[model samples]
Target: MILANNLTKTYGNQIAVDQLNLDIPQGQFFGLIGPNGSGKTTSIHMLSTLLQATSGSITINGLDVTAHPQQVRRDIGLVFQESALDRMLSIEENLYFCAGLHGINKSAIKTRINSLLDLFELQSKKRASVGSLSGGMRRAVDIIRGVLHSPKVLFLDEPTVGLDLPSRRRIWRFIRNLIDDHKLTVVLTTHYLEEAAPCDNVAFIKLGKLVSEGSPEELIEQLGKTIVEVSGSNAEDYIKTLKLSAEDYMLDGRTLLIRVHKPQPNQVEQIQATLRDSADIISVRKSNLNDVFIWLSSKGQGTS
Candidate 1:
């Protein structure tokens, strides 16, 4: 239940976000992806009413973010890139503090704390200092604290950036479960491609512009043909011979991605015949959202 129309933000000469238009439905898991300086964070800040937009407009749950900041805050929960938990406080104390901040009464605070602790699996660690918890545990606590008020919309920025694989998976499962159980609306920002796979819809941004927005499958379908990745010697020669676009070049480890318009009639066989003894076909697979991202960001700018 979030909408943005031609959202733009600038700091002096640098335009952090430009003409971004987003429409996210209720109970949908939306993803915002881009490179380091692609303005994803700026967009989130504007949406959260933490930073004022330079132009354009935003509304959440039918209230204008700028004109009705307090109303928007009442309906949305935000989990930042950095952990905002109080390291000195115990897990229960931290959530209790957040609940109080949201004007939750003392009588309901205890119930909310217990429920959140159980949902986030922090019940046993309730009395433990936040500093004593691992990064993943801290992340879970951070998210729980943000949602202590049981907000309608959730904004998560890089939720699992630095955690180990298990921790990352834990958060993923937790998020998925929360969405299903609570019917929550989520707007998650991340650069990790694998992380984007589970999202209901994805928005790709680059150079302060939104390049594409759709389901991952819808975007991948736009990039025709199966992708054949070959590795080892003579990749450059094969690329040149095929006249592959410079933008198509992907230095993914040792493999080179070759995108053909029509991958039929034994396309892999012809590649095997062409490369012959020069190179080896490391992997052959259909196109994916990653491929679509590379192609779109490299070719030119796009719109929703």
Candidate 2:
């Protein structure tokens, strides 16, 4: 339900986002990923109407975001990387305050607040001050506030940045349930690569340009089926002896990562035997989104 055409954003002479085009369908879990300073946040800010684009157009549910920003704001919710909650307010009070801002009916606000609290399992702590809650609990409250208005689209930027693994998983589970139950369209940008694996589609941004866009599976398939990582002082020499081409491997200091396309039984044993003597560490595992991201980002620097 979100579309952008030739979107661009700039600051002084530096372009933060350059000619990005995106089409996110309704109920889709879309992800925007890239390294730091790649303009992921700038793109989100423009799409969410927090920052104006330098050129091109963006639409949310067919309404032009730039031309009709106030109207577009009604259709989307944003959960920023930083917490937006008031530490001094009680959890219930925070919800009540946000409900007032959304113009919810006075009588209905209480019931809605209770329902959300129950869903997030924060009902027992409704009266506790936000400052008294743990980091995970506070982040959960931030999410609750963002969706309190029941907007059709939700924009989450680094939603799980500082949380522990369990908290991160809990947050994602809540997001998934929100999408399934409410048919919510989610646009996410995160540093954690594993989190993007569940996305319906993901786009990589670099140097303010769109480098690649595809399903997680499609992107990973481009790098082959498995990644064999060998680390040792003689790793480069070992790879050279194997006659592996530059395209088939990546050199990261002491570690050499080799892509093995559809590795056969004999090939696996052969690779192990070859590395056993020279490598200090050898690991063979399924390729993942992180590998695709690294390959694309490094490769895109010269081309994009």
lDDT agreement with native, every candidate: 0.83, 0.88
Give every collision pair in model 2. Answer: none
The global Cα lDDT (0 to 1) of model 1 is 0.83
Model 2: residues with Cα > 4 Å off, grouped in runs: 261-276, 301-304
Model 1 lDDT tens row, 16-100: 9999999999889999988788998899999999999999999999999999998899899999999889999999888878877
For every candidate, C-alpha RMSD to the true structure in Å: 2.4, 2.5
Q: Which ten residues in a row are the worst by lDDT in model 1?
A: 295-304
Highest lDDT scorer: 2
Candidate 1 clashing pairs, residues 3+ apart or interchain: none
